[model samples]
Target: MKRLVFILLLVFAGICCSCKNDDDGGCVGVDCLPPETQTGENTFGCLLDGEPFIPRGGVNPLDCVYQLIDGERYFNLEAAMNDAGFNEIAISITTNAKEIIENQTYSLVSEFEVGGVSGKYIFNGDIFDTDNQNSGKLTITHLDIDNQIVSGTFFFDVIDQNGELREIRDGRFDMKFTR
Candidate 1:
């Protein structure tokens, strides 16, 4: 079976990696990655697409699972919208991450799911170490923000629905705001 073969391959790969014969060999094992380069933005071409994106500085997937912090403003930029009005109105976003509007502030977390690919990401969310895609047909049910009505344009990197992936990058939506 494919599963059995995959498991055997992994076992062999692990053994070969531990062996001290990698300096020059036929099977180099799972490319020995640097300590800090084990997992990177989706651009790195990762098979397992889980959250906590960077494992550190970046917004851990856990944060996305929490409730949007209270007191944080959630303005409906659209005066009113319906199924026929999605994305037609404007939405301005401003976070307290910065002192004023002129400063680069907080980053919004957007969930993406389609064609067997899913993951939580930012505007230019890279799919690891690859030039997957940052633009795709958007389907938004709400637009909460603060300040002007949708200021700058928001960007998104869409995964290649038909591209290769080792993991299904699905995610749970639970965004909370904090000060």
Candidate 2:
């Protein structure tokens, strides 16, 4: 029955090959945004003006900093991406608040000295930031100080020099921090 065995093997191979999953990096439907994960996956993504703004390249596509400034704890997280032409686009959240705990929502203000959070967006040499008039919120979903991992979600609106408001939404990041 050698002939019969050969035919069965061919069928099995074809079935196995067909069962291979074609996953496009955890994409879901039309919006190919990365899934929101609390684990330290080092992922950063958001929707900028309704388009996907996922950090793609650079020495550090995703980075976080936790330090003490003048006896006050400071925190900063930055995500950057280089486009096809090498233009850098970045988004950052910073705060010098005394404590950064989980499940806390912070307001994104313009001034860091005012004792609140701040958000910034840089694109094509233009810098936009949150101000009293244009602001947003950042919610810390997970924070592990000993392990140096942090995960959060944020959204903000910033005004450019031309007074054009840019919207950044559906943002999420999970990464390890450095001191």
lDDT of each: 0.26, 0.82
Q: What TM-score would every model get versus the actual structure?
A: 0.19, 0.78
Per-residue lDDT tens digits for candidate 1, residues 2-77, read: 9999999999999998978533243322232112211111111111233211111222322211113453322211
Q: Pick the candidate with the highest lDDT.
A: 2
Estimate the Cα RMSD of every predicted model relative to the unseen true structure: 18.2, 6.2
List clashing residue pairs in candidate 2. none
lDDT of 1 at 118: 20
Question: Over 4 Å off in model 2, which ranges?
Answer: 1-30
In model 2, the worst 10-residue window by lDDT is 22-31
Best by TM-score: 2
lDDT of 2 by residue, 1-179 (tens): 99999999999999999875843464543266777888888888888777778876678777789787677788888888886688888899888654678999988886457466888998875777798988999999999988888899999999876778888899888888887
